[model samples]
Target: MSAPRPPAPPAKASGLRRHRALLARLAGGPAPEAVILGDSLAAGWPGPDLEAATGCPTLNLGLPGDRVQTTRWRLAALAAFAIRPRLAVTMVGTNSFADGDGETRVIAGLAALLAALRAAWAPPVIVLATVPWRESPPGRSEADRLALNAALADLADREALLLLDCDAALGPDHAAGLEADRLHLNACGYAALSGALAALVRGA
Candidate 1:
């Protein structure tokens, strides 16, 4: 009989990675006490300005094309990391325009994402932050944007999860600060978001 091949190396556990993915420097100074889980807004595309402003030394897991479903799938990978961040902040629903349904369905998907976040990160507290509203200018409807905000607001009552209003951080008054596409945050807008989060977490 052919010699039995050496037993294959045991498979790695779920959420474990044998290789490294790129990590954008999302915050400043030391390693983060917090982590940011969102789409492009949380990712510093323009630059590392937000990371410097927050002074939290964050790991930006923001995927530019991420949506509710993709976030859920990708978030699982964080489970293997040694760090259990002091805070986990997530912003989803901004890219749900193609959801092909009403707000109810979107809200349900968000809820599931939140649940998975809570279960996976096991952060002492999770901030279920709303996505900063996008500016439609002449092409998009304000009403649709409002609906996205509403879907996020619907999760205010979730236990151990705090609902943060992106409005308070970036509202109509802040509209002038947005980027050209009206979707991503510009320097001023991200500064506001990073500053707002710092204040909240500091007080806590």
Candidate 2:
């Protein structure tokens, strides 16, 4: 047998407290208006800027290097807080996209992740398309990423979840949206993303 899986990290106490305070102020107005949930990409999003852009209280529940499986596992922590968001935006699986992880597995994990989120959180989940990455080893290529997005589109349809493309904000090509490293977003990139996502959140 392989090594036992380590325990998942605890939710940030400050974040939970912030959520609770925000929830209390709202008096059951969906606690958090919007929650951005996913890996580093989601983490990089400017939460304050997004709130300003969308005119909603936004919570960032993103953890770096989170795979679909990790996201699924963390649902317990999210649910433990007993906070509900009107909209939850997620963009994950870019790190898990690799030759070793077959396309089928990636799709299944995504599907399961969405299902878990639907069950755990409230309605109006905005599933973000995985963004482009630099030509890094063990990561999926542009073509593969496109394929994954295609599959995700189908998954969104099947589950009746709202699907949005991150590329619109990031840029048409990888070079345009990505920073020098070609993965993370720069200030400009974040602005673009904030605009795109905010529009979606506002139903604009």
Candidate 3:
């Protein structure tokens, strides 16, 4: 068997509290006008510019290493928080593309996530933020990356979900998106995607 992980650290125990505090502030009270639920990109805080740009309380409920399945599984947790907002933003599953899952599988996972969101809360808008770019390893190429991203765009269209393409915003080829690790975002990259996302929400 694998080694057991250590007990939850203090920060870990208080993590939800921290997240709640942060979100509570963003929400502007017991209820928020909008909430953005996504992956690491969403969790990166997306800068204060978005809040000013949209003029709405935007909560980023993103966590690191969150796959599409985990996001749905965790939705119930958010339900317990008791704040209903007009909109919820969802961005997930770039990891699926990296781990050898095909575009079809990734889109299926995304579809399931959307279904869960639909069942849980009633929001006027559910913006399906398009999966951003981070280069895949050995067997993946730029074309493959483009293909999967393109597939997500199409899926969003068919579902009538708003598409916020971080890849396109970062650059057509994601050339401007990632840091040296080929994953995660630098400040510039984060700003790039957040700028587009903020603009999308503001205009919407």
Which one is best on lDDT?
Answer: 3
lDDT of each: 0.60, 0.65, 0.66
Q: Tell me which of candidates 1 and 2 scores higher on TM-score.
A: 2
lDDT of 1 by residue, 40-106 (tens): 6665533365455335555667666556665666665554454667777787666655434346656
Q: Estimate each model's TM-score.
A: 0.73, 0.77, 0.77
Candidate 2, residues 83-132: lDDT per residue as tens digits? 66777777777766743454567777777667767777764555455545
Badly placed stretches (over 4 Å) of model 3 are 1-29
Candidate structures ordered by lDDT, highest first: 3, 2, 1
Compared with the true structure, what per-residue lDDT tens digits does model 3 show for residues 37-110?
65566677554754653467766677665566556555655666566677777877675566666777677777
C-alpha-based local distance difference test score of model 3: 0.66
lDDT of 3 at 122: 68
Model 3 TM-score on a 0 to 1 scale: 0.77
> RMSD, model 2, all Cα superposed?
5.3
lDDT (Cα) of model 1: 0.60
Model 1 vs. true fold: TM:
0.73
